[model samples]
Target: MAARSKVMQLFKALHRTRKEVFKGDDDALEAARQNINAEFRNNLTESSPEKITELLKFGTDVEIILRKTVIQGVHTDHNRISIKPRKEILLDNVPFNHNPTIKDT
Candidate 1:
């Protein structure tokens, strides 16, 4: 019973993240929706608690990755595009491990 609740929570959270990550794009949104549904449906008969827990963790990680790493770019002009990054992405400013990072330059 507990595992079932967790599964539903993770599933819904992933969908919400998908909406924010793929906003304003019908094709991408539909694809994401289908993918999420398919993944959960694939595991609908899962009866192993350990395996379900592992899958839940993976789903949670995926949601985080989508929210933090996915950026939406909108076409504006022929040479210019606009980006609206989610706050989750901009909040983490991890620079590469180089002697001279962008901040130093």
Candidate 2:
């Protein structure tokens, strides 16, 4: 996989979680973000073999901060409801046409 492709994949995965996995709830958003982060981190192992490894690591860390921001966006919620991990579910459903090995950058 190319670095650009990996980045696009990561963004798409995160975007999917933000749109589908999370509702307008605080804990749910946080949980969704966490799941997305975890999925990105896991995929980075194969997506970005060299250069993107560090980039994805940074992305994971930044995602933690972004998750907090998302939580804050829904601070009005009182029930503190959380969404289940949907990363695997989402990934499993997405069709992949290739198993191409990413070359080291």
Candidate 3:
């Protein structure tokens, strides 16, 4: 329960930051780009387009962003989803410990 709440909090923070950053923008491209960049820096390999498109269906349910043209079949489904950049951050906020074992030659 707490984990879900934490996730929601983080998303809310992200949305708030996004609105502030792009008040007049028609899309959330800038915010999405930043999120993706941050995710990449953290070594969170993002899923491919297949996954992104699957995600779009969910986004529609959430009413985040959608295009009427796409809905009307004027554009491809890929164009409908503006995939925001994503990063994989640990929920517990623990520092990663890398310990490699040495082998005798």
Q: Pick the candidate with the highest TM-score.
A: 1
Superposition error at 18 for model 1 (Å): 0.9
- Could you give the C-alpha RMSD of every candidate to the true structure, in order shown? 5.3, 15.3, 17.5
Q: What local lDDT does model 1 show for residue 96? A: 80
Instruction: Give lDDT tens digits, candidate 1, residues 49-92.
Output: 88998999999999988988999999899999999887778776
* Candidate number that wins on lDDT, 2 or 3: 2
Model 3 steric clash total: 3
lDDT of 2 by residue, 25-80 (tens): 56766876677667667765564366577776676565444444433233336966
User: Between candidates 2 and 3, which one is better according to TM-score?
Assistant: 2
lDDT values for all models: 0.90, 0.58, 0.44
Clash pairs for candidate 3: 36-85, 36-86, 39-87
Better of 1 and 2 by TM-score: 1
For candidate 1, the per-residue lDDT at 22 reads 94
Compared with the true structure, what per-residue lDDT tens digits does model 3 show for residues 1-105? 443454345445545545544445545557565763464344334345555444444434333332211121123385574433223211356767698679899
In order of appearance, the predictions have TM-scores of 0.81, 0.33, 0.28
